[model samples]
Target chain A: MREARDAMTKYGRKAHAITALVREAEVHRDVYVDPEIFELEMEHLFPNSWVYVGHASQLSKPGDFITANIGRQPVLASRHTDGSIHVFYNRCPHKGVKIASEPCGNTGKFFRCPYHAWSFKTDGSLLAIPLKKGYEGTGFGDTQANGGLSKVKNVVIYRDFIFARLNDNGVSFEDYFGESLSTIDNMADRSPEGKLAVMATPIRYMHTCNWKMLVENQTDTCHPMVAHESSAGTAVKVWKREQGDSTETPMAVQLYGPFMSPYEFYEQSGIRIWPNGHGHTGVANSIHSNYSDVTGYLDQMVAAYGETRAHEILGEVRHNTVYFPNIMVKGAVQILRNFIPIAVDKTLVESWVYRLVGAPDKLYERALMYNRFINAPTSIVGHDDMEMYERAQEGLKSNGNQWVNLRRLYESNEEQDVTAVINGTSERQMRNQFHAWAKFMTMDMDKHAEAAE
Target chain B: MITEKTITDLIYREADLLDTMQWQAWLDLFHPEARYWMPLEWQQQDPVLQPSLMYEDLLLLKVRVERLTGERTFSQKPKSRCHHLLQAPQIVACDTAAGVFKARTSYIYTETRGDMLERYSGWASHDFVEVGDALKIKLKRVDLVNFDAPFGNIQLFM
Candidate 1:
């Protein structure tokens, strides 16, 4: 306990001095591996900032509710009868029993706690308790204005995505997202109906690492070649056996084959770092090229949004886009994953892929193919990632290293907006994340004092 | 008339094949057009709108098997071993047109990894089609007892 307190104090002191001039590169190793910093991050970083709850499609209609965690805080996101969305603390207001036990379901009309039968409307308004007569004598049986399920402050929904802020202060979802919102926009804009539906049951996984590691790994372009080497190498041999040559197989299959080619070609493909710490790395053009199954759907997109706009939307083939903090969007496969920190060492990831509404069934099938082959529990890619994450977590706990280096592209170049366009393999993304992290953790608490002065 | 002993023996042999990691022989047990599925548990009211864990056809199943046995498959480096125990096998129906025998069997399956052991109880509905002299699997639908519960990596063919 004493050691923990000392570490906390040390972090608290250093965090206070963090500024834009703190060399946007080179984060203290403690940030990634330390338990003390992880605890502080849960309190200061996750709770205070806008964290993704789930996609709006997950709860499309009235009584539709899905249980999701926002950094260890279990939340129930429901769509009310009036078509408004509510994110509420899952715990019952009375005796603190969890309101819903299932991962997701339609409550029909209201949420009823199994423990005491205390019910709340879909909007989380207090409806009635079975033993209300006993509570009438006290000040307990109040209406929505007084007693109800605790609502998450400031909920924002944009383009079928839901984000919530526990603290009302800080920034609006627009300001918080900045240019990162384009990833969401581009995804939705591709659909002819201007919407996408959650295509399949989400594949959930638990990784024994800080949630940040998984989030960072999404944009860490360098690891794919090394980490997925075995999978890719095998893919090449299989393709050779089946198709007899690489040219005969489809690009999707070819991309998965031959690990060496991707790493070598990645430099030519280049990466683009956006204004708000969101980075896009990998082959941009191949995302929508020669997807035979989606050709008709692409035509519809061209018709709905116009050919020029459609081209622009389809042209942005960013493999991974880090929406800073909790959300990581994979544009190529239309997979969105959110990392919810379970503990200092464990992270719960909910992976959801979408089907472009009004698109052909074959297109949806293609998406499912990618989901099953690349992201599913049985996936070779997912297994490799999980192994690395678990290993990294175990390695970081050792006394062998005090700091993890982020000095790869530290001195090459700098961006005015605190985002640098470093080599895709550089640790710039991790450094950029910590830069944003320190800002949120040590936010000016003395604003009122300064105002009073 | 298929006796209980014959059905039980067949099921036990199938489990043995899987447990012993005889993947190719297991694959051969299925008919060319076999449909294997593990559907997601949807709300009792609306089934079509929601997605399932698996709604695979033969092609997809072939791809899955190919990938699993593929040399580069990293997830299967240390293969998974499962012990399937069938408690009750009830004959559901016999279709002459399809030349298929249908049966539903309740099972308890346990998988061990090092010291970690996880158990799952489920009922499987098997459809077997007799082609010439051999019996081939037409379909194997497994409905887990706790279908909605969060599961660990389901790496193996369940």
Candidate 2:
């Protein structure tokens, strides 16, 4: 803890200088490249802020658990026998050994540590420890206060999505999410049964770039044209040959193949930025209408939730919704990507696409197609983005320039609370993200100290 | 009765084709209407109701092969090298109507990129449809030992 504090203080000094000239909307190039800033981010930002752990659907039944990382800290998200969810340190209380080794499984009744046979309830209560008489008069006892699994300060489970905050006092999940909550709401509202389940194992990848790169790319409407040119070009040619010029390929394929074309077309689509750094960019209506697969899902949604409400939900064709910081909700494909920063230069990305309950097989297939063809590790499109991100990271590390520009549409647009509409090709999303990042990073360290006191 | 030697020989031939990257020849080993399925490991009550990691038809598989073999497939720039070791081959069932002999085999597929080695152990169940004198796979299902582990690019057919 002391080492973490010292590291935070050292990096905090650097941040002070960096933040002064960079502004809230502008980030220093070193933030993406510097190891010191990355360590500090792990200590300060990651631990204190609300980090998404996993989806509630992942641990749906009692005794079901998924082992995941909250920033750098290993957290076990378990569904208790009482039907409540608990997010705690994966380490056992007795010996600090990780209880659950597998990514996910059912523990049955209780979690028994393999090392010492120390058992704990799924909710992280100490159930039993081997050789109980050894600790009869000792400091350690089978009590919650004595030593249960060190629980996260707060765990918020909303609509099967689980978020945990290490810090006790802060904004409520709703307040913290603010405008971003609508992304989740929109995702759920699209489902015919008004519920969604993670139908498959998350497609995970490691990128040799800053985690911020992945988050920024999630909604960067401009880069698809230049960065993803090769893949998109191939997609277009294939679609042309397979479906011919007259027929339209599925939206998933089109999204992957003609991704570059969208960048060219997005300028006319009009990008809308919301306050709290959440926004969407793209023509909402025509994009959906273009895809025959989505029409059936949209019809089902309309039937379930009426025409007006369903139209409002389905009409919001957001290519990406920045749930601020790490989570990105791609509503069109019913996929969500959570960015986990490993180092300043290393990031682990988990891609999960949900199955809208009661939706047609075709609708699910559309999302599955996107998952397999576009975002999967072997994806032509993903490889392009991965290569670009790696190059960007390498370039930033060089002494070529101190500043990375987000000055694309700087003077063209005014910031609005609900929607800050910018040019489709603008870097406003990047600017908005950095602004939110700065706010979270520099937010009162003294307040944290007071809370500790 | 399908002899153990015959099944082993068939598996060895298939592995050799894959290891040599004879993709077209490998494709010929599958029946025209064969199904290659790698179902998603679900916690659900029924797998039929759930989505899969790969539920592919011949059209998709053809496209996948085309992309992998394409000149501009960036991920395939430095091609993946693989070694398949098949063990414990067993004839599970025989279908008289389809003239298909179903067999289960455990394999350890070791892939190498540069110096990095990744070994994946999985059990593969193949439904072999006897066509004339040749045996073609009517269905091939691979269930990886670590089916749920976070994986990197699986560009090649497993």
Candidate 3:
């Protein structure tokens, strides 16, 4: 371990660790099982990156707030009187007590700290202090930083998808995300009004596994055929039995049965890996290719966007897009999921369904069905993935195999870069992620050291 | 007067069938067109418009049964054992002319699988209709106290 530490440089130390663990085709089990590494991830990757906070639509009006977390820090997001969004630490500046207790609520005008009676504006600017002149000349309220509820270093709202970074030393969210930001735009553009909003409260479930497992599973096409064999296969069998010799199945069956698509189909789906560790697979022509059309919806879209533009908008379908560290989006169904790592082995997955504003009732209904049928805690498909994730976490703690293989389909004919298109079945996405993980962990060490110095 | 005692007896009888895993007997309690619903929201009023944890017609119910009892249902491989403890039911409403009756009851549904046990306690309301000779369930709604809370995999009916 000391010898590995001796190879340390501001940038090159990560390279040594990267080479030792993540390779072109395989990764070591220590990444998942080690407590020290998890701490490093929380410190480096989560707060430092452009982490997703919540959507602007969720904080509808001034004073509407939603409390969320970035890494281990409790963060609060709200809309101020100026109609701008603010993401700040949820703690009171006085004694560091939590300001809001609920998941979401409207703070109306200002937030009054329940503990010390200190008040702050919706944007977290300190409003008024209780007992005004207690410390007349003691540098009280002398500096803005010392007075206000501290703002997160950066908050970016790209077409309603809100993101914040605890560390200010990163690129713009657009520059950081690159082409992957289009998934958000495409989701919003699907509606006739060219906007999207979250409908209903999100359905959250817990996975007894490390958080990374859930993130990687988003674009993993290999497991659906096997892991989801029971639920997907059951849907197909039951639909067939009910239909006898008929060629058509119910929409529910159609939605689920596609998980059992032939390996050849997935191979043809194609995968897109962004240089920034973001990736997604082709999905416009999926099992939902022939999903029943909602009456009057297309015409409404055409009326709003014209024929050509509407058809182009309607034609685009990208399945699940992993927005790097946080957020997984299923474009067709409008289900977005992100995981909160509660502990070393526990993760809470929050799944939010979206409503394309001005879209027909049927469209939102489909999203609701997709969310209820798959993302809900009672979902059979989610159970299968959860079971595998928990089992993997358990197995990694064993002495049987020190290496978890990502070697499948890694022998590439495709050109490799930070951003590259590959076969859907290839493990390139997972490899791409670890490549970023190594970089984030190693690079942030220099920052932490500088902070210490 | 059909009597509250009879209603309580019927509710307990239905529960007994569920605890004992008598799927067929439980099915027999419901009318052919009955709906069994568990709304995702706390006081969800409309299943069609709102999301629901479960909204099953007879066909869907049969499919759930098939999956739970079938040979290859991976999650239910070892099967789930449930014990239902019901308090005496109270009649909420009765319309003899329309042959419709509604009763409210509370129960604790304990499900054991492998080495884990989960208890779901909730108020339930059964809307019944007099079908020919006996009572048949028109609607069965489980207002789970934890409906607003997240849950693990729920393999058995509440």
Q: Which ten residues in a row have the lowest lDDT in candidate 3 chain A?
A: A6-15
TM (chain A) per model: 0.88, 0.90, 0.92
Worst 10 residues of 2 chain B by lDDT: B42-51
lDDT of 3 by residue, A227-336 (tens): 77777777777677777677756667767878889878778887889866788876435545667778898899899989998888778777788887867987777888
Residue lDDT tens for model 2, A1-453 = 864665546455344643553553466786798777777677666665778888888888999999888778898999988889999988987667998988889999999989988888887878887787988787665555356788986888888889888877765777777766767887787788888887677766667789988888876767776766556665665656766465645554655554756655777676667665666666443243355544477678888989899878877766777776688887767888888888888888778889887887766667766775556555656776786787788787778667778887776444534556667778787777676666566564554553353
- Kindly report the docking quality category of candidate 2: acceptable
iRMSD (1 decimal) for each model: 3.8, 3.2, 1.8
Candidate 1, A234-259: lDDT as tens digits: 56555566654435566446445533
Per-candidate fnat, comma-separated: 0.24, 0.26, 0.41
In order, what lDDT does every prediction score? 0.69, 0.72, 0.79
Task: Report the number of the highest-DockQ candidate.
Answer: 3
Give the local distance difference test score of model 3.
0.79
> lDDT, candidate 1, residue B18?
81
DockQ of 3: 0.55
TM-score of every prediction relative to native:
0.84, 0.82, 0.92
TM-score top scorer = 3
